[model samples]
Target: MSASSTRPSYAAVLRMPYATRTFTAALAARLSYGMVSLAVMLAVSRATDSYTAAGVVVALFGAASVFLSPLRAALVDRHGPRRALLPMASLYAGLLGALAAVSWRPGAPVPVLAVVAVAAGACTPPIGATMRAVWGELITDRRLLQRAYSLDGVAEELLFVSGPLLVGLMTGFAPPAAAVAVSALLVGLGTTAFVASPAVKGVAVHVARAGARTRLGRGLVQPVVVAAGVGLSLGAVDLLVLAFAEQRHHGENAVAWVLAALSAGSAVGGLLNGAVDWRMSARLRLPLLAVGLALALGVAGLAPGLVTLSAAVAVAGLFVAPALTTSYLLADESAPPGGRVRAGTWVNTAVNAGSSAGAAAVGLLVGRLPLAVCFAASGAVALVAALVSWHGEASPDVRTGEAAELVR
Candidate 1:
C-alpha cells in the first residue's frame, strides 16, 4: 500500500508513549485560557456595572499576557517545564481565584479588579508553548511532528470555540464569578497533572539549556511575519463578513452561520494538511498558503449574498489552520535547541497583536471605504507578508536545515 494509504497519522500521534496523558493535561490546562477572557469580562462587568470599565480591564489583562509571553516562555525553556510551569500556573490560578472573589460582589473598585486581572494574565503559564516544545521532544520524525502540531492546533481551535460555551452554560445557573473560579481550578489541576507526566520529566533532564540562554535569531522572521498576516486577515474577515451580511439584509444570526462554516473548513484543512507528507519545503509552502488564504478572502467580498459569502469564507478558512500549523513548525525548527517554547511564543504573540490591530483598522475603515475595498485591503495584508517572505531568501544553512522539503 502507498504511504498515503496507510492508517491515519493522528492516531499514531496519540499513541506515542505518554503522549496521550501529557497532551490531555496540556489541553485541560490550556482550556482555561479559552475560558478566562470571557469569564473575566462578564465577571468584571457584573462587578463594575460599566461595560467601559470591563473592556479596559480586559484589554489591560490581554496586553500584559501578550507582551510578556516571550519572557514567560523563556523561563519555561531555561528551567524546563516542571520548574517553570508549576510556579506560573499556581500563581496564575491564585490570581484568577482572587479576581473571582472580588467580582462575586457588585460595586468592587474597577482599579482593584484591573490590577488583579493584569497580575493573573501576566502569570499565565506558557502552557501552549511548553506543550508544543514537548511535542518536539517526543516526536523525532519530522513528518510525525508536523502531524502532531496539526492535531494540536485543531484541538486548540475547538477548545476556544467550546470554552465560551462552557462558560455560558455555567453562567446560565451560576454567577459569572463562578466560571472564573472554575477556570482557576482547571488550570491548577491540569498543570499539576502535566508536570507529573513522565515525558515532561524526561524532557527536563535531556533537553539542552544552552539554547535557552541564547537569543532567538533571524530565522524566526518569516514565520512570525506570515503568522501575523494570517491573524490580520482572519480578524478583518470576521468584521468584513458581518458588514457584508448587514449590506445584504441578512440577520445578525446569519453571520454566525457563515463564521461557523469558516471554522469547519479550517478544522478540515488542518487535518488534511497534517495527513500529507509533501516534498516542498515549509519555507516555500508558507508564503503560498498565505497567498491562497488572501485570494479566497478577496473572492469572499465579491459574493452575491450570504450563501456565496459562506462558501468563499469557508474556502478562506481552509487555508487558516494549515498556514498556522506550518508557521508553528517553522518556528520549532528555527528555534535554538531548547528555545522552541520561546520561539513559538513569539509567533503566538505576533498573531494576537495582528488580530487586535486588524480589528481596530477595520473598525476605522468600515466607515470610510467601500466594503469590497476593505476586504481587498484585508487580503492585501497577507499578500504583502507573503511577498516579503517570498523575497527574503533564507540563509544557506536554514534553506537546507529547518526549511527542508515540505511542499511540492
Candidate 2:
C-alpha cells in the first residue's frame, strides 16, 4: 500500500457505528465528570470556606484515582469492560450524590466530607483505559488506531475547555446541590452508554493458558513509566499556570480562560496528529514538545498581562496531547498480545500518579518560592522528559515493524 493509502482518516472511523457509539459515551462521560468537578469545588468552597480545603479535596480525588486505577484495569483485564462498568458507575454516582447531600447538611463534619471525596475519587474507573480498550477492539489498522486516538485527544481537549465553564454556569445559576445531582445523572447516563454498546458487549476477556500467569506482573512497564513522567511534568505546568494567575491577581474568572487556552492548544495538537502522514517518530515528537514547553514558560514569565500569558500558554499547550498520543502509541506497540487492555490501564495509573505528585510538589514550591521560579522548574522537568524519551531504546514491537518494512 502507498504511504498515503496506509494512513487512516478520522472521517472513515467516524462512519463506523461503533465509533459513533464510543464517541457519544466518551463525550457524555466527560461532561458528567466535568460537571461534578465544578459542583464539588463549589460545594466544598461553600462548606469549608477555604480554597486550601478545596485543594485538599481535589488532591484526595487524585490520590484515590492513583491507587484504584490498577485494580480497575485488572478487573477489565479479567472480566471485560461490560461487566466491570456497573459497580464503578453505581458507586461513583451514589457517592457524588451523597457528597452533595452532606455538603447541604448544616454543620457537616469536615472529616466526613474528606472521606466521601476519597471514596468517590477512588471509585472512578479508569475511563481512559476503558476507552482505549474499546478503540483497540474496534480498530485493527495501526494507522486507523492512531487517528482514533487523535480524535479522542481532541474530544478530551473539548471537555477540558468546556467542562469547568459549564459547571460554573450551572452552579452560578442553580443551587450547588442541584449541580452535583445533575453531574451524577450525566455520569450515570454516560457510563451506561459506554458499557451497553454492541462493540463493548462483544468485548471478550482474555483467558491465560493454564501455565501462563493470570495476572499482569504489576511492574512499571517501560512505556508506562515514560508516560507517567510526561503526565507529572504536565501537572507541574498546570500548577505553574495557577500560580501565574494568582500572582498576576487575575481573579477567579481568569483561571477558566487560561485553562481553556491550554486545552485549545491540545485540541489543535490532536488535529495535527490526525492530519500528519506516517507513524510519527518519538525522536521528532519529543524534541518538538520540549521546545513548545520552554517557549510557553519563557513567554509566561516575561509577559505581564493575562492576554500575553494566555497566548503563550496556548501556544505551549499545542504539544501536550500529541506527546500523550505518542506515549499511548508506544504503549500500544509494546503491549503483549492479548495484553493491550492491562497495558493501557497501567498507563492511566501512572499518569494519575504523576499528576498527583506533580501538583503537590509544584503547589508547595509555589507557596515557598516565586511563581516564575515554579514555571522555570516545570519547564526544566519537561526538557528532562524530552531528553530521556529521545535517547530511550525503541520497543521491540516497533523495531519489528520497521525491520519488516525495510525487508518489503
Candidate 3:
C-alpha cells in the first residue's frame, strides 16, 4: 500500500463509501448507551424521591449489561449483526418504554423498576463492539485500523460529554420520563439504520458451537484485563478531580474546566496517535501506555494548585485514548478465529466492570481518606494493570489467510 493509502486521514476514513451511514447510525445507538443509565437514575429519583432507589436501578442496569454483553456479541458473531441487532434493539426499546411508564407513576415500586432496568440493560445491542468488528473486517490495513479506532474513541468521548447534557436539558424542560423516552427513540432509530447499512449487512457470520469452545483465549483476556485497569484508573480520576476541586473551594465551573482539560488532552492525543505510523506491537504498546498513564496520574495527585493539577490532568489524559486503542488492537489480534465480536465485548465488559469497581471503592474512601491518597490509588491500580500486561504472553500466531477464512 502507498503511504497515502496506509496512513489514511480521519477524513479519508469517513470518505469510505459505507463509512457515513454506518458511523451515523452507530453514533445514534452509542449516545443512548451513555444516556440511559443517567436518565433512568434521574427519572427514578424524581418519581420516588429517593437517591438510594435511583442508585439501585442504575446499578441493576449496568450489572446486567456487563454480564450479558459477551453473550450478545456471541450471538452477533454466529448470526450476523442484522439478525442479532434488530431483535435485541426491539426488546431493548420495549424494556425502556416499560421502565419509563413505570417511573412516571407516582408510587412506582422500586423492585419492579429494578427488574425493568435489568431487562433493558441485558438487551442492549453490543453496537460499539459490533462496529469495531465491522471496521476490522472491512479495513485490512493495520495503520488505517489504528486511525479508525482513534476516531471511534474520540467520537465516544464526545457522545459521553453530550449525552449527559442532553439528558439534563430534556429533563429540565419537560419531565424526567422525557429523557428516557428520548433515549428509547434514539436506540430504535439508530439500531434500525445501523443494521440496514450496507457495510454492516455485508459482514459475514462465523458459526461456532455454543459452549466453552467459544470463550476468549487467554491471550485476549490479558489486554482486556489491562483495559480494565485503565478503566479503574479513569473512574478514580473522575471522582478524585471532583473532590480535589471541592477541597480547593473551587466551584462547579472550576471542576468543569479541570475535567474539560482532561478530555481535551485525550482528544488531541487520539488524533495525533492515529496520524502516526508506529512500528511497535500492540502487546508492547499496551503496557507502555499503562505505565505512562500511571506515572502521570500519580504526579497529578500530588500537584499543589489548580494550575498544576490541570496540567497534570491534561498530561495524563494524553495516555487514555492511546491505551484504549492499543487494547482494542491487541484484542483484535488475540481473538480466536471466528471470535472477534466476543473478544471486543469482553474488553468492553472488563473496562466497564473495572470502572464501576473503582468508582464505588473511591466513593467510599473519598470522605474518609485524603484526596491525594485516592489519586495515588488510581495510579496504583493502573500500575498493577501494566504489570499484568507485561507478564502476559501474546496470542499464538495464526496466518492472516487462515483467520480470514475462519471468519468467512
Candidate 4:
C-alpha cells in the first residue's frame, strides 16, 4: 500500500474479524486496573481510619506489581495467553476477594491486609501486554499495526478517565468495600472473556529456546528505561495537578475536570496521530514527542490559575499517547524473537516503577515546595526521557507485511 493510502481508519481497524470482541474484553479487564489501587486505599482507610496504614498497603501492592508484572508477561510469552492469563485471572480474583474479606473483618491486622494486597498485586493478570501481543498477531500490516496501537493508547486514556469515576460513584452510593468487590468482579469477567476471545485463541504461541535468558538485554533496555522516565513524569504531573487544585481551593470536581481535559487531549491526539502517515521513524518520533511533552509541562508549571493550568495540561497531554505509541513500537521492533510480550511487560513495569517513584518523591516535596516546582520537576524528568530516547539506537523501519527481525 502507498504511504498516504496505508493509514487505516479507526472503524476499519475495529471491523476486522474478532477485533471488536477482543478489544472490548481487554478493555473490561484493564478498567479494573484504574480503580483497584484507589479502591483498596479507600476500603482500608475506611476500616482502619488511618491514611498511613492505607498508604502502606497501597505502596506494597504497587511494589509487588512492579516486580511481578514482567514475570507474568514472560509466562504469557512462553505459554500463550489462554494458558497463562486464565489461571492468573483466577488467582488474582481470589486474592482480591480475600482482600475485601479482610477489610470487612473487624480488627483485621494491618500486616495481614498488607500481605494480602501484595499477593493480589502479584497475581494481577498480564492483560495489557497480552492484548498488545494479540494485536501484533492479528495485524501484520505496519500502518494498520500503528493505527491499532494508537487506538489502544486512546482506549487506555479512557480507562483512566472512567475508572476513577466508576469507583467514586460506587463508593459514594455504597460502602468502600463495594468498589473493591465491583473491581474484582469486573476483572474476573473481563479476563475470562479476554482469554476466550477468538483473537486470543487464534494467535500463534511462541516457545523460547531451552536455557534461553529472559531478561531484557542491550537493544530493548533503553526504550524501556525511557518509557520509565516518561511514566515518572506522568505520575508527577498527576500529583501536581491534584495539588494545584487543592492549593487554589478548587473543589474535588475541579480536579476531575482538569484530569478529564488532559485525557481528552490525549485521546484526540492519538486519533490524529493514527490518521496520518508519518515519514519519520519511530526512533525520531518518540523523542520529538517527548520533548514537546516536556516543554508543555514546563509551561504548565507557570500557570497562575485553574484555566491556565488546564490549558497547559491539555497541551502537554496531546503528546502523551503519541509518545507512548512510538515507544511501544520501538520496543516491539527491538525485542528478541519470541519475546515481544516479555519486552512489553518490562516497559509496563518500568513505567509503573517510575510512577511510584515520582509519586513518592513529589509527595515528600509537596508540603515543602511550591506546587509549580513539582510540575517543573516532572518536566525535567520528561526532558531526561527525551534525551535518553534520542540517543538510543535507531529503530528499523517498519514495512507493510514484513516481520521485523530482532535488532541486536
**Predicted candidate 2: what Cα RMSD to the true structure?**
4.5
Better of 2 and 3 by TM-score: 3
Clash totals in order: 3, 0, 0, 0
- The CA lDDT of each predicted structure is 0.87, 0.69, 0.82, 0.79
**C-alpha positional error of residue 300 in candidate 1 after TM-score superposition, expressed in Å:** 1.0
TM-score of each: 0.94, 0.85, 0.92, 0.91
TM-score of 3: 0.92
* Best-to-worst ranking by lDDT: 1, 3, 4, 2
On residues 1-408, what C-alpha lDDT tens digit does candidate 4 reach at each position? 122343477777786778899999999989999888889999899878889999999999989888988788877767777877888888888888888888874566899899999999998898887777777767777788789889998998889788888888988788777788888888899999997887787653443341034444455655676778778888888788888888889988888778888888889888888888899877667778878888888899899999999999999889888877877776776665457788778878878888888887888888698877778888888888878766654433333312244433
Query: What is the full ranking by TM-score, best candidate first?
Result: 1, 3, 4, 2
The local distance difference test score of model 3 is 0.82
The segments of candidate 4 whose C-alpha lies over 4 angstroms from its true place after superposition are: 1-7, 207-217, 394-408
Clashing pairs in 4: none
Worst 10 residues of 2 by lDDT: 207-216
Off by over 4 Å in 1: 1-8, 394-408
